[model samples]
Target chain A: MDLQKMMDLPGALAAFTYSDKGDLQSHVLREGTELTPQVLDLLAHSCVANQAIASMEARGWEALTGQSGFQPLKGFSMVGLEWSVVVDGNCGVVVKNRDADYEATFNALQAA
Target chain B: MHIVKQLMAIPGVVAAGEYAYRGDRFSYEGALTDEFARMASILCRANTLSVNMQSEIFDSFAENIGCRPVQGWIVRGSQITICAVGNYFAFIENRDELLNDVMTIMRAKVGDVQDDLLVNLYARLGGDTKEALY
Candidate 1:
């Protein structure tokens, strides 16, 4: 996906794509934003770590219930006072404003 | 113990537990096996640590643009929902439909008992029991 174009959505302050191992793959930041690559790497790893935990939880459930075909997680969202982060797999989008339309932003990200 | 029991009392709360940031379970109650519950608690602690780290990074840039600190995180999956309250963690299973309501109740219940919880945790760690009361 064209990550930069996807990041151009309204209220999107920054976006990053990482490998399954949490390595930084690509990123976009709004002009004048003070975020750094090191910080971005930390954020990416955090997202991947979250994904791993969710995956484990899913496996645990499958084991307990004898249920097969557990689907991997699509993504998760964290809302803060000033920003909201949505992470899907290795891709993460950080909205500038807490009130940003996360649903639309997520839809746009997926469609992109 | 009381907190776990209260959390378990809530509708759809399949499991409730308290764990240290280092992955030690203070208490837990649910249908999950002991090993599975411990793993979940530890994973939840890791998730919380990550959230806190992310928040700190954002805070460093808050001066450039006004931003408030992160309060907490809620990660909802198909079969479970994990919630972080303070340094403690809780997870619910097979209750995706009641996640929001359960979280709200759990948060409030946790708040009410956090002092006692901490005291007990302190004592469990072999800290001075008298100091824990304060």
Candidate 2:
């Protein structure tokens, strides 16, 4: 794999990371937002989804998702039924219902 | 480790692998843990929301073990910018958890507003090509 390509994968996916001081930093971005889901998806695709498998397999990271974006790329393990993104004030709660029957994950944000 | 397995059960929770803070890998499972008592304490704290189910648990494990836990997630959106800092890792485990985290962060900037279009815009911004944050 091309070194540039390897690096580009992370770039394409919009992957991000944060520090302990809440001073958020991202590889693909300058600041990291705790509430954004789209960015998270991109990061997963590059890291956990496609490149992650290759990276892990080269060194060997276990396969979480059997799907084929990358043969070894670890797909998300779906354990719950409903996944909700609930926002309250400036804070958001990403909660999941363990039961497979749950549906709605987003509940109306409480009035500030 | 039942905790590890429980997290793997969630949907969109990729890379449900196990790791040791002192050892070698850390697995992230999406969604917040159902441990009401612990969650309640976190809830009582100001600006506490379940960024992801496993995020809190991983933090707790870190606290107990005296090792920092590592998590990674991607944020994609139309208006959102992706800026280059370094290698960014997400604390929230899965897609659902990441969505919740995004809403929580947006609420602070916007307000108690829920606009599907706006939400979608923000989400799209996460995947900004140049990686600009604003």
Candidate 3:
């Protein structure tokens, strides 16, 4: 896949290119890759993980996305650093930064 | 000199020194000596983890890799131990994983987005310093 095609996915961060397979290997997004019922469970697991962490720190948690209309999850504090991962498509993980260059890299990934 | 260089390589390890690991008590202070748990939070942050979650992760990782979590010091409520005859270590996986885990806990508290970028960049530079000593 080329840069534009790979960037088609919303919230892409970075792309890992491989060799030999001649295709994109991985694409990373800020939120998650899928909204399907299967992924809902994983997303919930991630939420559980976050809640567990909050319990240990005596704090609460929330979630965020890039979409304009998307209401950011409540209970999240705009305080310290945080990270989220989502597995989608050929991409093994998705991160938060969604710059043009990052998108290009994901587009350039080769198949392994 | 080597120890300092190695410790500095870890993402969030501010400092390390000649931590005395006698019997069960450990202490460090000198030109190249530091105490345990002093940088537990920092270390945990760097590794994308927190003090409380590290023990279970480490234990699972040890079991997976067929190693033991030895006794050495306590940092941020997690036990710091040397593995592989004090050559390698048994802690969180890497900086990216650690930072990711931290961000998960913080729930976007700070710069979860930026941190993910920085952590990935640093992790890509690649070379496990904490375990390199082994």
iRMS of candidate 2, one decimal? Answer: 14.6
TM-score for candidate 2, please give it: 0.19
Q: Where does model 3 sit among the CAPRI classes?
A: incorrect
Give the runs in model 2 whose Cα sits over 4 Å from its true position: A1-112, B21-134
Q: Positional deviation of A46 in candidate 3, in angstroms? A: 2.3
DockQ of 2: 0.03
Name the better of 1 and 3 by lDDT. 1
- What lDDT is obtained when candidate 2 is compared to the true structure? 0.26
Model 3, global lDDT: 0.27
User: For residues B1-134, could you state the per-residue lDDT of candidate 1 as single tens digits?
Assistant: 46677777777676677676356655678776777667766666666556655666656754433323443466655555566664455566544345545545554555522323334334545657675455
Write down the TM-score of model 2's second chain: 0.22
Instruction: Give the root-mean-square deviation of each candidate in angstroms.
Output: 6.3, 19.6, 16.8
Docking category for candidate 1?
A: acceptable
Cα miss at B57, model 3 (Å)?
13
Error of 3 at B131 (Å): 5.7
* Candidate 1 Cα misplacement greater than 4 A, ranges: A1-49, A56-71, A79-84, A89-112, B1-3, B63-71, B93-97, B109-134
True-vs-predicted CA distance for residue B56, candidate 1, Å: 2.2
Q: Give the per-residue lDDT digits (tens) of candidate 2, residues B1-134.
A: 34335434434433222222111223334332323213212221111111223333433433322111111222221112111001111222324344433323322323221212223223433555234323
Score chain B of each candidate by TM-score.
0.69, 0.22, 0.23
